[model samples]
Target: MSDALNVEGIIEFFEKNARHPLTPEEIARHLGVGRRDKKRLLAHLDELVERGILVQLKGRRYALPRKVNLVTGTISMHRDGYGFVSTGEPEGKDIFIPARFAREAMHGDQVLVRAERGIRSDKPEGRIVRVVQRAHQTLVGRFEQTRKFAYLVPSDPRLGQDIVIPRNARGKARSGQIVVARIDSFPSKNRNPEGTIIEVLGDPGDPEVEVLTIIHQHGLPHRFPGEVLAAAEEIPGEVLPEEFSGREDLRDLLTVTIDGETAKDFDDAVAVRDEGQGRIRLWVSIADVGHYVTEGGIIDREAYVRGTSVYFPGRCIPMLPEHLSNGICSLNPDVERLVMTAEMLFDAEGVRLESRFYPAVIRSRARLTYTQVRAMIELGDTEEISRQGEVYPALQVMKTLAERLQERRRLRGSLDFDLPEAEIVLDLQGNIEDIVRGERYFAHRLVEEFMLAANEAVAGFLSAREIPLLYRVHEPPSAEKLQQFQEFLSHFNLKLSLRQGQVAPRDLQQLLDQVAGRPEERMINQVMLRGMKQACYSPENVGHFGLAAHDYCHFTSPIRRYPDLVVHRILRGALGKKGLSEHEKQRLAQTLPEIGEQTSARERRAMEAERDIVALKKCQFMVQHQGESFAGIISGVQAFGLFVELKEFFLEGLLRVSSLGDDFYHFEEERHRLVGEHGRRVFQIGDEIQVRVEHVDVERRQIDFVLEGAPPAAAQGDVADDGDS
Candidate 1:
């Protein structure tokens, strides 16, 4: 009897239940013994069943069957009524929920599940008993209307289900426009769930429509509530004496803001000078937004949830109201602003010599744009220049320091891509007027390199002191990804083997220097970039492999990113009679993973939205000059076709497989190449191919093309009419 209850377990079958059956092998696993030890434990478990102390289900799987309380999990419903209860943990497999037992739970709803004794699989099965939490209170999508009802096709790919709207609940859904909807009736046995369209966005093709749709889809608030805006407006413009007294007076530090001419919200400024002995002193002054927005205050909570300011193509969705982001907290020239400053001394080698971060009040002496600085520094004493009287000398000194820093960084492992960046000039109606490539001059490089140095210096200082703070980390690529990349390089007879960890950043930079001015430079660098993971803020400081920095953080741009703001607050606390609570410190450690996830996700969304808009504009540009011949490179190849990007406009389009004549073409996945079956003709990615525009599908955002000087074995009728596709 004692042996029967030997195993530590939750279930204890009574003698009446044991009358059913048992197998020693089944009872071993059931009794919580290791599978490897099942043979010995199995003998004991079988004796328990023989002694009438345990029961076995069919298939000889032993269990002490009882009416146990159920555990709760999220119900992942399907288009059909049937669903499964999925636990939050990664290891837990989902429990099946049959239609009869799955009450009215919709997709993404947390629900109570009762484990029932029934036919079972590898894991337990359950029936949904009660609803707990609903994932989304509102949804954004394009609406489709009929005479009797309306439906919303969700904008988010993860949503997975269309929302049905009754005629009375349609509210204001237009046939083909985006709208936000609130779910009303959940799906039941006889009827589809109903929703009310709460908002109506504009047409799909418009750029504004795209940005707003994305913001709505993510449930990110684009505009502040009236009360919040009012609260922000009431904040006083003047700085208190108490605020100015505790800060370092960097007002006469010759600090200058170097940003784009169009930028109104200046968040960071740069100041650098030769400290002699082949050393340089660099200081990055970030606008102290945290001082104006206090902890647990209205603006602070809003910024915390928003986390970071989102910059759309033409506009920005400021985390704080404009009164602070663009006005009081902005680092305007000749105006005193609170700041969190990082000052570092570096030898000519660009390595920071023990840095210090402190709270300061600084006056930005000049607001210089990249255009003006580039012209003044490079083409000194020219038209539209030489207006600077007070700060011109200091700008020159700063420019020299930046050049030294750049030289040192290049000698190290920094991968200076210097890729062409596209910028759109929009008309008053928000239509694209011109697409310009932003130039990278010494002045721009100076600010960037200095800010990077300052950020790293501050991060290193905190780490050396063993302070827990958010750090920006970038690890080396996975071995699998690196191997594939190495294979890609072997095609050009270029071999790079990373020793153990990341290959030296300097080695990668040397490879870049070798490939510069070559035809394959763009393709090679782009692929190399794709192999590296994005850098993000976290409490765990795994050194950045790309920048080759041992420690890094976002101490600049407090106006844009929340972590920077947090750093600013910490600096304030260190200088004042205060420190963060243990709760806040613990909260920082706990929330790092979640913060990393959301920030990374949102950053991708922003990039995707930008890419989509640019591609659409490129397609539109192609539409205007459809018949014109252009030289392009084969950017991608698949079984169906080849994707070509034009050299003239940097636009991309697909050359359909049918355009390659009657030959059947198959894509070689391993080699990244496409081969023609009949003629044995081959086309590879990164090959230069000229193509003419054949068709454009604006609705699907796809462009079609036909190869130039190639015989059409199969005449192209439609974009998808590619043979062997």
Candidate 2:
């Protein structure tokens, strides 16, 4: 028998046969396994059973889980006590597990689910049959005490159960303090999980403690390991002369970096030149992080674990130690830094004529902030232009090329949501001073266009060489989501055209353009965004649906993103004009899939942590403004309430339906609105209304609002339009 007759072969045999459960002897006989391989075959069967891939039935028979109406996946618990199990298949729909059927599976736990009938055929329900792996060995929560014993209320509501902490296990933790607890016993159907306080963070309301809570709750790595730090310390702080031996010397290219004013780690620098006849040559140089952190080394291993840097309001948990992320690999101005450069030539219509990548050494001419670049380019400020000195001419060329590239993308049907992002301002003491819409000028878009061009160019380049690398893929929306979106647009007298049961990016872009300057513009944009699929890292290239590009990957910020660093390594191999060797390709092919999944999960964790901390800050800021009235727009409508976004502070709060004291109301699911039965009042998304800040719950990160005036009466079952008021 061949060595291939292992786990994979066993699964293949089961899949192909699709017969009744078979015993180990029967299965081995079917595969023609020899006597020497019998022990290995038995071990493989046991491993599959443990992984929930194969279920060992009664009488020592084995069958695929699906054959027994069982699905294996990670369970994601909702705050309302129910959970959903994701099968991790591209076309698989989540199986809903009701609160009663959830059993003991908590959020993120991999479990075996027994399929059950549900009301909707499209949505299947299931019950947890077994927990294959526990997601949380420890949890962060608020400490609480009673007369006899203490317990922890998990900061993450999805946990669904409080962990009981025995008196002896409480340690120095006091009531109302944030603490980390290690689970001593997992939750069961009849009892909650038991844990001991491992570390007490601090009082909940403290700014530092609030941030720390989110960090621990999400399991983010905040500090570098000593070995990783020592490895980083071993690297030189400056680029040596011999380091540029085999690299192109672009030190005199008048290159400049454009970033936020507060940015310390500059990863990308750009230089542009007009080559006459509406032709432009652009160079995008990114920090050569892979050159320093070799693969599978101490630093590389830690960076792989971190996946990506996590940024909060005033702090960041960097992927690499500061010595590398902020020093030699940073590409700081006036210092010679090693970089992987993407050089391309583009014509007037923003069509890429030619592109190439190479290792290079560059001395940055200047570091420019987005605000300054905007002033110089958009406002044509003389002082700002003069202040840039030697790089002024290059900035002008950069602006022209960026505009052409942006227009090309717009013409090609790229979706630009342009949604407002909250920029949290902090005082000297780290307390939130204000929350406002972040400024996004054309200058920001200018850099974005360049980065997109380089990313696509590099992806296309490496893909042509047949190298395996991670691609930033954004698949199209599903047909069901498109139908729901079309229904929503119909309520606003709008329509989304679908081609062959699929809506194209251009169709959505057209709809966006039609709704510009209208009252429902923001609401429609948000809904359309929700309908689209999330972009993730994958070894297989599905193309980026939102960008409307055939090839796309993240290649600009290798310092912060692991996927970018991976791409850089592949690009470097191809730079020698000889792509990766057979051994290297085989290794990557075997590992890239798992790497993609791990990095994507870590990315989501970082995003969730960032969102939680920002919401906490917003709630804290709103505490002082309780009971004050503000103009707002109904951003979301659900059965229980309407979520209103305040105009002044950009904070969102719920206006519960029960608070509509004038009349009884019912939710119109299709219309996405709440309608009063007797008064004929309406509360729908995009409707401008006045709301008073009734309450703010910092612990739960919630804000509650009440109507400022009596509910406005409208025609029966009619949506309030912009002209209605």
Candidate 3:
């Protein structure tokens, strides 16, 4: 028996043979126990049966029973209720949990499962016997009140099960109203789980209703928990002198914070100055959130579990309270704040010679938005750079330095992906007003280059120091995808060559440069981008293929992301009095990879939520302009239909191939298009055509259109807006 176990002497007899079949004679020989003791232990083994751990047979064979292998993992459920358990197994394939096997384990649940190796299908499958932890018990959906009971049909299909409410718990839910429900339980004998109507959102098909659905679907807190808010309110909203005890004093240095107009969490700032003999020193300071959120503290643990702040277009689910995230931790102009600074000295060639990171106290002299910076770029008059001239001249110098760094990076084969990101303008009541894109200018580029350089420098230092930290790694796509891309691109007379270990970022960069100023440039660039893998954080350093950076980590936004917090903590531990223990280091090493995966998944979900909202808004916008013809380019072509992007407001819609009037279109897989058999009409990606809005589907967030004539006199009756570039 294990020394840790109680009643060891008699248990020793059972443990000797792993509680296998044993006659009294054999048991007596193993434990040197009397017949009486053997009988007593046998009676105890019978008691263990109550826990389902051990079983006894007619042959007196007492062995460990076939209890399911108790594994804990997050559930990834599908629309149809079936899901898979994403076990953080380094080698074994993920276990599939069939619809019935889920056993009420909702999506993202940390479930305890008893899995056996059994399969009638190709994939491995497992059954969930118990749920260790529920990711969320509350869900968002529309309530349906029948004569007898009510039901909450969830907006997120991932929930997979409708919550049924009996007459008493139904509340005032009408026949068809949007509502949030709190799950009570899934009865052993019932098909649906029971829940209570906790909130009434609104009627279905409302603009804000879609966003609320997403917020509830993800289980994001609309605001801070009461205790958290109370704790935040208790803390002062200013940096205290005692808190800056050991931090380096850089408040005297000129620094400016740059962000979007709506951004309140000003967590980063930049400053640059000529050091001597054509060398410059650039400083990147990030808000020292770690100083406020201490280890093992309530807020700290919550932040760790969340991993990052989630940003919606019109809202944000912040990691820290606004009093901190947008107040004390915010590097507002003319106010002293604690920061974690990365200082680097660079030569005329933009090659960094020295760098170091440490805690510091800084005062940002100005708060500049992208709009103001863009205006400055337009004027070409760098006079009004910052609120104070002290920070303004430094910003000009920084912009010059950042440009040089960008040139250096581009020369080093870093691919530039300046994708068009759109923003939604909502009124006070959260109604979509307009969708506008950011003006691509030097202002945005300067900020990006500086942050990229700082992140790269920190990443390099961490790697050189052999620090175990998370690095964002982007892997090259599989050979199969590359070959398919090559074949697909051949249709456009574009040839892309790929050889083993010869996939240089510079090659793609050069291709993009060559395709510049062409109509098909954006389409080809998007396709090439899709052929690359997503970048994610991991303890192991796998160089980022897109950036061509040998080392890359996120050290710029500790306010938004958790890995940055870990980096700050590690850097502090490595260089400060608070040295990390070996046990803590080991724990980080074991946990980081899994946490990275989860955070990356959440990031994707947030992006999708935003996209889904935007798509819905576009559909709403289209509903108002139905039956009007607008010029559009084919975004996607399928056998069933074609997705078209409207030229007017940049909205997208799908044109059903069946509605193309008496023509049978066959899908040409090789060409990524559909071809009409009789009319010789063809619909392929990037084909510009005028289409009248056919229908708008609010629930599905889809727009249907019917194809009309060709491009509006070379795609819109005018010299296609030169500013489009």
Candidate 4:
């Protein structure tokens, strides 16, 4: 039996019944302690209070700290030394903690905090009482040596404090070099942490070294282990004859892949056929990654850890090694590859009549680029169509079906927010060449419509039978966010109908349509998009709001996404003649929630890493173009600065209010603009103006700009306003 005086057990009891505070006598009775042991239990409770595990009320009642208005959450620190704790509650309210109350808690650290509601302002406040876990044991930063002392300044701005490096802990790191340091001691409230330099990266000015620093800072695995490489090498290059048994033979189907010019892994392919009487049969073939990488295998575990493939400026960190991702699993032309097929029959009005899912072995008829497909279907280029004999006819029919599906989605109020995405250009040595906005054509939309149809069909099939699986769910926006968005739009004379504390997707669709082609179109669309919740994976079906679909799952691109691979496996088990066993079904039900959370985190991490690299490269490109003037649109306006996006280049920079030639500017938050008191000039969102690149700070990944035609302070007395900034 456990000890009767166990302090941990006493704390656990309070934690388990945290909602109900218990007096000393009640706690003693609940612990089954007699009068003789009551004194010992009280002593233990006092000790727990001392350790911040429990709190004693004014009436001498005991309770868990969380029960007494204290909460637990992860802290996100800022460069200015303050932090915000995210409690992950449905209300989405973050608790602001002052720099003094942080108690040395680092960024990403989990901590217990005492919340003070509606005290200082409308926003809630919190104080860190105890740190539950540390997020970092090693740090990446630049090393500096003084006359008699040394220190490391962290590369991540959120680290909040520098680490002191003792004389002996300097290792071989030289001054002004980037190095990885292992923390020898965590920080106290009044003292900075100490660390030892372990690995010395090269100088900070080198491009290659900066990229490596980013990878190391984010804890990304850049190289495969020896065992994993060995395992990848063991896989054969060709599909075995025995592997095709019991699989549908789709070699005769006119299937083709449409991807970018540089894409090596073609995981999805499309085919179409006219069924006569205004009907069509569409096939979406996705590479069967589950067939090659079994569950709990080395490669599978690695893929799970990586989550998704991360694409940088000129390189890719694939989830799987090249042997699998680009070779066997890729649906290369003329190669027999295993795939899972979703065959759906649709009427002329783009309503699904029937759908079927099955395992299949197929040889891709041709590898087509988005440009080539657009040339045939939209541009009607005879040369492009003649290049592919039988596949050309199938492509034409696919276009017609895609158009119908798009029209159907339009009627259903599926939102299509066309935000411009930037694509960075690089030279052979990985240096910045240029930045260009991503283009959209009919070919891109056609492929997207077909994929969406296949995903919806597969998801609907499994959902109808109540199977446990990870679904890509996009929930509706929270009421608080919607109300804020409505207030923001009210300034522009637009009204959103909020009914019964909820708004429909069509309401947003109508608003977007009303503002189309206006100067405020981009601003309104961006704010509305921000008000919506991000799409994430969940075992519980919440439906997809953005897609306007009752059921949706990602079934294509299994080679790049772990959830897609898991979906393929589940479908394979369920499609068999015998179906799944009771044990298998129960196991899936028990494990899918955790997998949903894990894959969601991994996807976010990959996206963040990709975004960081792009920003880094963009900053590098701007260094060469400093002082060059370009036409730009005001993307954002704040109390301090205006954010401008260049027209000819996919780049954005900030123009500080201080650079406006001695005018005192005041930010008007309600109208989303800034006004100068002396000159009476105004700058607002969506106003086109000319700006010159003033400065670029590569270390901070920031670009600064100045207004191109602003007069000097001596000559500003008689200038006309022109109603423009």
lDDT of each: 0.72, 0.89, 0.74, 0.86
Which regions of candidate 2 deviate over 4 angstroms? 119-123, 709-725
Single out the weakest 10-residue window by summed lDDT for candidate 1: 1-10
Better structure of 2 and 4 per lDDT? 2
Task: Please report how far candidate 1 places residue 1 from its true position, in Å.
Answer: 31
Per-residue lDDT for 1-725 in model 1, tens only?
22443532313533334443456644443455566665556565565444323444467655442322455677766434567787644345577888777746666677767765458555667787556566678877788987776788876543546789778777655798888888887766566567888888878867777767767755567888787788889887755667897679888788889998789899998787777887878788888888788877887778777777776557887778899988888998887888888888887665667677788888888888988887788878555355877567777777777777778777768778847866667778777776666577887787888888888777776677666777888877766667777888787778787787447778878888888876567777888899877777777888888887888888888787777877766556544565656676677667667766666555555565556556556655566776667788887666678878777765667887767775667788656678978888888866887777777765345777887766533454444543211
Per-candidate RMSD, Å: 9.8, 3.8, 7.9, 5.0
Candidate achieving the largest TM-score: 2
Off by over 4 Å in 3: 1-136, 157-162, 184-194, 205-209, 381-392, 517-520, 577-584, 708-725
Clashing pairs in 3: none
Which has the higher TM-score value, candidate number 2 or candidate number 4?
Answer: 2
Q: How accurate is candidate 2 locally (lDDT)?
A: 0.89
* Top candidate when judged by lDDT against the true structure: 2
Per residue, candidate 4 scores C-alpha lDDT tens digits across 616-703 of 8888888889878999999887766788999989878888776777677789998889998988889998899998888787767788
Off by over 4 Å in 1: 1-137, 155-162, 185-194, 203-207, 240-242, 576-598, 619-629, 666-688, 708-725
Q: Per model, state how many residue pairs clash.
A: 3, 0, 0, 0
Give the TM-score (vs. native) of candidate 2.
0.95
Q: So what's the TM-score on candidate 1?
A: 0.77
Off by over 4 Å in 4: 1-65, 117-119, 709-725
